[model samples]
Target: MSFVTLSNSRVETTPPVENNSDSGVLSPEPDASMQEYYQLQMDLLILTVILTGVIFVTVCFFYPLKIALNYLLGAVGSVVYLRMLAKDVEKLGRQQQRLSKARLAIFIGLIVVATQWNSLSILPIFLGFLTYKAALILYVLKSVLMPES
Candidate 1:
């Protein structure tokens, strides 16, 4: 509590305001709210891997081996991109104020190689790179449809 004196000899007491700004020193361990965020990140990563496997198997069954291999490469790159994004988000405010462009470099490199390589098909690889977005859409739909779960 803090006390303040008025000009007319009046006195008042007030509670101290809590500081919630990120400029302050952060705790060594994340709090409960941050735990939920970390859990969501893990869940997204898991869901992406599951979708990648299902799609890869389906592609292998329907398409040629070369196209399936190209898609697998792109899907792996997508997973790497997702993890890098999560790491960058986790470091936000503590280490950096903005997201890094380094993550996009992986996708650009993949596209460049796909365009240059004769065996790789651009369409399959591009679709594979969107695997993470598909997983995220599924996650959001689940959350919206089944909030209690």
Candidate 2:
């Protein structure tokens, strides 16, 4: 058995193996900005969930259950859609792929149906749609005003 001692006096005994034909080259580690970007993504997801819960609870007091549900559904759909857009943009690059018109049409259709049904309050639903953007703006403002050292 062999041991490798580290500067901190820790010993690692695992033997290194010779490269094999089946082994693939390892990818390089992610840079600091990439790590920060993913961290922000996680933070945004957490904030969205919290915001959705708060909106659902607060709106329940003034609106009917159905309306409140619709508002939550809209808000959740918007957040999912925005997250999808972000992922697409990241994967395909902004210049390579813009949001499709069909997606916009479908979203508009949802709003129209909700409005026509009269069971869903347009105001709350619209506010729900804006929830993700509001959260994002707050996050950006916080990051800018109180930047990490």
lDDT of each: 0.85, 0.67
TM-score against native, each model? 0.81, 0.67
- What CA RMSD would you report for each candidate? 14.8, 10.5
Model 2, span 70-108: residue lDDT tens: 778778877776676555544443235565544455367
* After superposition, candidate 1 runs with Cα above 4 Å error: 1-28
Which has the greatest lDDT? Answer: 1
Error of 1 at 117 (Å): 1.1
lDDT of 1: 0.85
